[model samples]
Target: MSTVIKIENLGKQYRLGQIGTGTVSHDLNRWWAKIRGKEDPFLKIGEANDRTTKGNSEYVWALKNIDFTVNQGDVLGIIGRNGAGKSTLLKILSRTTLPTIGSLKVKGRIASLLEVGTGFHPELSGRDNIFQNGALLGMTKKEITKKFDEIVDFSGVERYIDTPVKRYSSGMYVRLAFAVAAHLESEILIVDEVLAVGDAEFQKKCLGKMKDVSNKEGRTVLFVSHNMGAIKNLCTKGLLLENGETKIYGEIDDVINQYFKKSDAAEGYFTSAKLDKSEVVFIRSIRLSNQTGRATEIFNTGDDLIVDLELESDEDISKPNIAVGIKSKNGFITIGNTMLDGNQMPDLKKGLNKLSITFRSIPLLPQEYFLGIGMRSYDCKTFLMTTKEIGYFNISTRMVDLGITKPMAEEIAMDSVSPFIPYEWDFGNGNIQSFNILNNVIK
Candidate 1:
């Protein structure tokens, strides 16, 4: 295998709240600066890509000085928060956009399925779009004809093959687009979160196809998605981008662990402006604590765990129930307790209230999970306030003997149903039982 894709000093700059030189003076200034062998004057005025802040500069770098490589037959998973320049980098790689600085070298035909109906014309039928996409990949008519059936069959959209893509639902669009990209003999495949539009069954099929392309066909893939499970599954390497900068690179598992280690608040306190709130009832505070009642974001599997919450209501509340739970990386509830889930709960007093739920032993397998909290009326129909994911925590099942601390996301069980460790066993020189199957007899 060779270095098929290499990028050096790649960067992308954008002007916030404006497109293409908001004013003629600014554009002239930039050009003048460049002609004088100087940096763009606007480049000196941009703020970091932090989404929460009110940016001070009109210019921002969606991506800056990113340098990495993708070798032949490598599946590199790129992950980060929204606005981390994931889409921008892919656009540059796919030739849909040009980087403001640096260069990219590509050695193979690239097939990119970026967004819903990304490459397809809304007026073109699915069948026609197949050929269109192939052409975009530099494929000839004969070659596309050869792979046409496989693409259509894989997409499972033959019934609507002749229908204009504009009529296709989001799911159907992604299925057809992905199918075309996967089977059209392209050497490099770049996929975004388009598969998120498909059903679970289809998502599974796409993942399998990606694996086959990389493992069997010896192709390269650049994938970006928030689905960490999928990232861990099909990728041998990972690249984590933070605020438009390269944070970590290399082995998939280590990169993911770095993400968690850098992301979650280990002190067990999480406060976000994105939490769901309303005037009726809203979250005042959310935290996680261990056995000692000290704030912590990391806990051992099968050990005591605690969740504390402070909520507020503007008006007198009646029959309000509180709920707390841990959500997996996939956004599913691993386990939780609710006041409305057959538990008698007290009414929340106006202004402020505090509650804590304690678990004798955390049953979760070794993994990292999100903290979820909600406040609602007892009837469950009245939505007072809720925060789907306000904080993050990790369950450490460090095997002292093996010195294992971090387990990959996919290796952990879905539900924390069983305690994975901390059990006792003893074997004395007492009589032992043995069985032999060769002679169909037990001895």
Candidate 2:
């Protein structure tokens, strides 16, 4: 297949502090020099983006020396933790932004769904917006007319087709917007995490549509999702981006494995120190270990997962609701086990409590996963006290799994041992009655 997208040592840099100052003048000068057929100005090469003691006088390198290529009919999965420059890379690919150090080459029309309601005009009716987007995508009015009803039906917003998009709910807007982009028949489709906001069933349908768009239509797709399951099911290749560089680029399975390993090594899960807390309670810390109580970050499928949690209680409370959630490296929340989901446990004592959650065998596949811890008053209807993305770990092994919940299963043996030699039994009604005698000497 032909290459549809190509990046050569792509790098994007942002200055520290604020934009628009003497820097604007310098950028203008560079633009004028380029227009005048003079050598580039900023190509003089200054310090890098590191401000450590005696370090390069710098701002920040949002992306650095990134290079990758996508072929036609390929569904490429992009995976990374937050602030991993995934969105920055997408912006560059979609031409929404420019690279500071490198360049990109594209060979076809690109339809991007980087954000919800990306290209829709809020003031326009859903029907009008569809036509407008189609036009922008180079589709003729007759072409859009042929597919108009199909798009409306797939979006499930036929009732609101004539209503202005600004009056539509977020889900409704996304459904219609995605419909227009997906059905417009663009050669290269770039989708980000916008599909997450849709309802479960719609999300499933969107994933299926994306699969069809790539496999059946033979179009190239660049999908960035936090849902590991979707990526595993849809993508044949994967690209792992970290610090604005491609860390691993190969088959989907291997790329996902490397991304998970690196994720487990990240120090903290939250971007801010002031985590989400409430008057009821708060989470102090979360840790993981194995059976022998050794602090291990790497685990195997079916291996025991010991989660230790430390929490603080604001006041004296009884029967506090405690819950632990397990999310895959890509943000697909698989298991959310809560004490409230099961029989009520003992009331949490005062002040502080050390809770130990044990999973006899983690049913997840080999990959990086996160644990989100939450707490609340048992009687309180909602789980008010919660800390998200509290901890991270990695699981790896060569094991075929069935379901998410790996409950213990067993089988019992019966004492009927027979082969060529056989025995016979008789049934009687109060009186001893024999039905057969050695099968009548084999008749």
Candidate 3:
């Protein structure tokens, strides 16, 4: 397949605090330089886009020396942290903004859904907006008419097709916007995180449509999202940007793995003071330990996860709601626990406190998992402290526990078995009956 889009040395620069020259004289100097076929003086002093650092220059590069190519019918996923220049790159690709440097080559009509209601005129009716977007994508009236019904039906807004979009809710606007962009017959499609505003069902529909567009219609796509699952599912290739610079570009799985390695959980330990902030109650430290009681980031199936929590408080907190949430490396919240729920929660005294939470024979399949801890008032109205993805541990596949009667590889999950819970089964009335299947394992 041919390259549908190519960017070489692509760069975009912006002023830090002021817009369009601090003074008229400077603006004239820039115009004179532009007219004389000379480089703009401001370009020489632009700083790199490292958000963590303070720089002296008034200009910063939103994107610098970005080079990549997207093949025809390829779906490329772009990912990065906030202010990492993801939106800026998309804006440049969508022609909504001009890059201060470098060249961008395009091979087809590009339809972009960068933001909610990006191409729509709010005063116009949904029906009119659909036709307008189609027209902008170079579709003739006849061609747009042919797809009009499909677009309206897909948007699930047929009842309000003639209603002015100004009154549409954000979700409705996203649905209509996505439907038009997907059906407008554009050869290339670009979608930003704006799709996240849509409901789960609508997002599923949009993903399916993008798949159809790429596979059935042979169109190219550029998808930008923070949802690693979505990116892994929809994209065949990936591009990772940090500080407005391309860090990795290749197959999606490798790219996602690289992403996991860069995440906070990958550190296996979160020690920063940012984890807790409440004076009523605060966590002093949180860490993970394996069965041997030694701090370990790697775990085998059927190993105990010992979570040690040390906390402090300025005032006595009675019956504080304490919990720990375990999330998979893929960002799935696998299991969460509270102070045994509906039971007598121990009163937390002022000053230092210590506790250990243990998950016997961790049942999660071979993968990485992170921790999210929280504490709140007994009434659940005030949060003392809460943290997410504070630390992570890895689970490697291991043989079944030494005494297990039967074990299946596929049975592994957040809860494969409960050794701590006691239960009784009775064959009553020729039917099996259970007593307290979820009876307390930890007491």
| lDDT tens digits, residue span 224-247, model 2 | 987665676679999988765678
lDDT of 3 at 434: 25
Q: Mind giving the per-residue lDDT tens digits that candidate 3 earns over 196-287?
A: 68776787788888889999999999999876656766799999888888889999876766655444342334463544444466666776
Q: Which should have the higher lDDT, number 2 or number 3?
A: 3
Model 3: residues with Cα > 4 Å off, grouped in runs? 20-23, 29-39, 263-266, 274-324, 327-370, 374-389, 392-443
User: What tens-digit string does per-residue lDDT give for candidate 1 at 1-443?
Assistant: 79999999999888888665558888888899989999877777766677777887877889988999889999999988788889999999999899988899999888887477667899999989999877877789999899999989999999999999899998998888788788868789998888768887898789889999999999999999876667877799999988888888899877766666545445777654434444477666677778888887777766666666666677777766655666775564433435423454566677877666665566665556877776677777777875456777776553432354444334334333443211111112232222122234355
lDDT of 1 at 199: 86
Give model 1's clash tally: 0
Cα RMSD for candidates in order: 9.9, 14.4, 8.9
Residue 405 lDDT, candidate 3, scale 0-100: 28
Model 3: weakest 10-residue lDDT segment is 420-429
Clashing pairs in 2: 226-330
Counting clashing residue pairs in each candidate, in order, gives 0, 1, 0
